[model samples]
Target: MRPELEPGHVAVVTGGARGIGLAVVEALGARGVGVLCVDHPDADTSAFVAACEAAGVAHAVASLDVRDRDAVRAGVATAADLGPVAYAVNCAGVDGLHPASGMTADEWRRVVQVDLDGVMFACQAEHDLLAGRGGSIVNIASMSGHVVNRGVTHAAYSAAKAGVIHLGRSLAVEWAPLGIRVNSVSPGYTMTAMTATNPPEVNAGFAAQTPMGRLAEVEEVAEPVVFLLGRRASFVTGTDLLVDGGFTAW
Candidate 1:
């Protein structure tokens, strides 16, 4: 296990209250790493709090929107109180389903703000926390960034995620001298609360398109994130790992 992943070291995970973010928190807790969960003010964190207690790991919650720069900085500072902050995962994001032709400016801005801008704000704050101490940062991007989904029309989401993938590479270069490695994980269709709400046939279509013939599990995506955040990936940086069940293989 990486020293950064061992017990006593803290990690800040945005969108930690649910979905992939929550899964990452669980994975980190199982590794004995403290987690500072940053989510929207209105997000329900009961489950997140319970998981942390069940895992018996040090945990804290910062209820603030990631789009706000000052709020993100304060959230990272809050995580610093637990111990040495060594890792961070930015997973707070929103999807835009509207087609590019009919997408309004506000609609486009909303998705880009939360998906791309949010990641940037979180990264900036996390960088400050781990600057001299050295650490790892993983931004949760999507395979949508790589290829357009067969039946989906989310231009904004795809654009924002594409930005995230490159953003990690750019930051990795600039921060390497400071000992901070940056990377991204792109997941295929995953069964989460949001996806679970979709019609069964809708999900089946997703499965049919993937070479793996199935959607990815939340845990499946979480493990790679843990690996990237640990010492095992010590020399790995400026890359994007696709945990997409071979969705892009074809």
Candidate 2:
């Protein structure tokens, strides 16, 4: 176990079934934090549970869609059964690549509800649980929130992510007095299941444009999130950490 996180501390990770969320869950579990992995009913939650068990970490799994307020509240309540939730990572989100003119209302609403509203729902629940414990939250925004993507017309996604960043900043101030810290992590062109289906040339072009000439690995992003959740970042709050491999440098 990592020296920063000792056993018995609990951390709840939304979208923990896979990708960056899964990586964060693993990182926390490896550090001896009891993890509560929340995801949609359709996600491969068994895999996450298996991984946690393999890491010799205590964990629980909940099938939840973060967009559902009642479900989110209930999930957080259930997480308390394990221990105090010392950290909450909001990583459940969706991406829509439709042109602004062609995007439908439902599509726009779905993206916003999942990315923005869902974040609020999770944060509120987790904040309630961590009220006196002085836990931290790490919301997963994106580089798209800070910069426009000319190749993809992800207007809805970009707008929602922008809201997430602002929401994190606001929560940081609102919760600071309560001893709760809030922050955000914005990633750029990371390879994931969603990006795996993107055009090979498009992905290559994005990597080429990065100063590092590569996409960030899931672990690279997870490490910062873990740091924020630990005491090492005790004084940090209301800030956005960009882990884009210098993609935003230009």
Candidate 3:
């Protein structure tokens, strides 16, 4: 049987408004876990939370930019008021897919900032929240971190995800003493708002290339994330779990 999370234990999920992050929130919330939905100021999380309210779990929404360290810290504090933030997942990022040649310096910075630096800022801010509780941290990476995609080119996105993997490993080593486990999850072509932006040709191509011959559902990717955030993964850290449909293997 799978281990169950305790009640009143809260989690912080960046980009919790939709996609894989939204799925994670719903999963954990259904298990009686309080969660803080942290997303960009422009993201309208109000409706998402209203829908989740039917699940009968406590939740909060923080409209803060991950690039701002101070705002991240404040969000952590706000979440702590609800309950101990026993789990945190940095899922806020953009699929900055553009040809390397046409990708301007600003575009590169934006991708790196959200994908890499955002994860760092979140973990740093949560240090105090997870210190005594000895919780879990999961950084959302991508299969692009391991293998380059054929149709899409996102040098910054891939590089930053690669950095996210290493960042979790490095932090796992340092935070182990504090009983904080840090790990990463990489997904290939999953059905989410991010992938919905792609053209039909691009989506079809991704499906054909996957060994599974299909794209993954959001819940499929969120399950492993929940596992890593729970007691089941108590001894697991510093590892990258590929939730890809054998995309990297192929």
For each candidate in the order shown, give its overall lDDT on alpha carbons.
Answer: 0.93, 0.90, 0.88
Per-candidate clash tally: 0, 0, 0
CA shift of 39, model 3, Å: 0.4
2 against 3, candidate with superior TM-score: 2
> Can you write out model 2's per-residue Cα lDDT over 52-132, one digit (the tens) per residue?
898877788889888999999988778888886788998999998899999999999999999999999999999889998
Model 1 clash pairs are none
Residue-wise C-alpha lDDT for candidate 3, range 1-250, written one tens digit per residue: 6445766788888999998999888888778888888899999896559646866777898899998889998886788888777998889999887899889999999999989999999998777799996999999999998888886789999999999999999999999999999999999999998988788888889999999988999899889999998888889999999998899886
Show where candidate 1 strays beyond 4 Å: 1-4
TM-score for each predicted model, relative to the true structure: 0.98, 0.97, 0.96
Clashes of 2: 0
The pairs that clash in candidate 3 are: none
> What is candidate 1's lDDT per residue for 63-110, written digit by digit as tens?
999889998998778998888899999999988689899999999999
By descending lDDT, how would the candidates be arranged?
1, 2, 3
Give candidate 1's whole-model lDDT.
0.93
